[model samples]
Target: MNTTTVITHQPVAPAPVVVKITERDWSTSLCGCFDDMASCMYGMACAPCFACKVSSKAGENCCAPCCVPGAMIAIRMKVRTRLHIRGSLCSDCIIDSCCGPCSACQLSREIDNSCNGHLM
Candidate 1:
């Protein structure tokens, strides 16, 4: 008689956390500033001022809060006439390479959220 053996594999670790931002947070990050100009043609700069405040409290440069390495992912969810920011509890490197004005869509999304979805 003959017998066979099998082995199973396991995940190395849990997924990283994703960072979420509100319309308020969007105004703080530097990316937001750029996006705001692009989206609104410099008309809605005051929209995301709250985010700038939170970023200031956190000692963040510009309006965006610095994300922990491999700890968070940014997501954009539509809310009413404006777009809001929401962080996920996991990280995803969806856009590792692109090499444009914004390399990754994730980064662009974060910037958009920071700018209150003003940029296209």
Candidate 2:
């Protein structure tokens, strides 16, 4: 007669660890064109030089077209959202130094850079 023994073994491979990237809320304000507006609003005074304007009756902010050729209209507005990357790591700092027309564009560039071009 022969005796047999049974043994149990654990799995050879270990589970992989998943790292989740945290998102943080960030906000920025800029001034530019409103995208859609009738000419009757501003009339002759509407030079499109300063897109940012205050509605005389509504008391709200408004935007207009740009005066310079090839230069898009720039308006002032607030941009708020959650970013996947941290502020310090953003590339806006680099772009701001190189080519930035306004503080808002510079900040957006920095955010885009920090997010590795993933900023929306």
Candidate 3:
């Protein structure tokens, strides 16, 4: 006499999906501060206040920039990372160090545009 065995195959769970984020340029350029006169004036009139505002808008503590040294660069990095904007820490440093007010205004505009669905 001979005996035979049967085997059955079961389906396995599918692999996890990986989303590839395509880095893009900032919604507004660093020097595009003047494009939004309101923000530009606000930033120029009171840079610290503007920085704090942008910091808060970016989801960081409002006072972080005022209390922490080089916090703007960190804020820029955070915003850049959050928005998947293509930029480097060195460039952020240069922008913030050269014209802090302008950087703040740009960040503000970027945040505004992001919130307004202007960025894809």
Name the candidate that leads on lDDT. 3
Number of the candidate with higher lDDT, 1 or 3:
3
Cα lDDT tens digits for candidate 2, 38-118: 322343244332233221111223332233322221211212224442344234444323433443342333344444433
lDDT, candidate 3, 1-120, per-residue tens: 999977687779999999999999988888896679988988999999988888888888889999999999998888888899998999999999999999988888988888662222
lDDT of 1 at 115: 57
Weakest 10 consecutive residues, lDDT, candidate 2?
70-79
lDDT of 1: 0.34
Which ten-residue region of model 3 has the weakest summed lDDT?
Answer: 111-120
List runs of model 1 lying over 4 Å from the truth. 1-67, 75-92, 96-120
Top-down TM-score ranking: 3, 2, 1
User: TM-scores for all candidates?
Assistant: 0.19, 0.23, 0.81
The TM-score that candidate 2 achieves is 0.23
List, residue by residue over 1-120, the lDDT tens digit for candidate 1: 899866587648988999855444433342343543443332234323433333332234333423433211221222111344333222123321121122222344454454553433
Point out the worst 10-residue segment of candidate 1 by lDDT.
Answer: 72-81
Q: What's the true lDDT of residue 85 in model 2?
A: 27
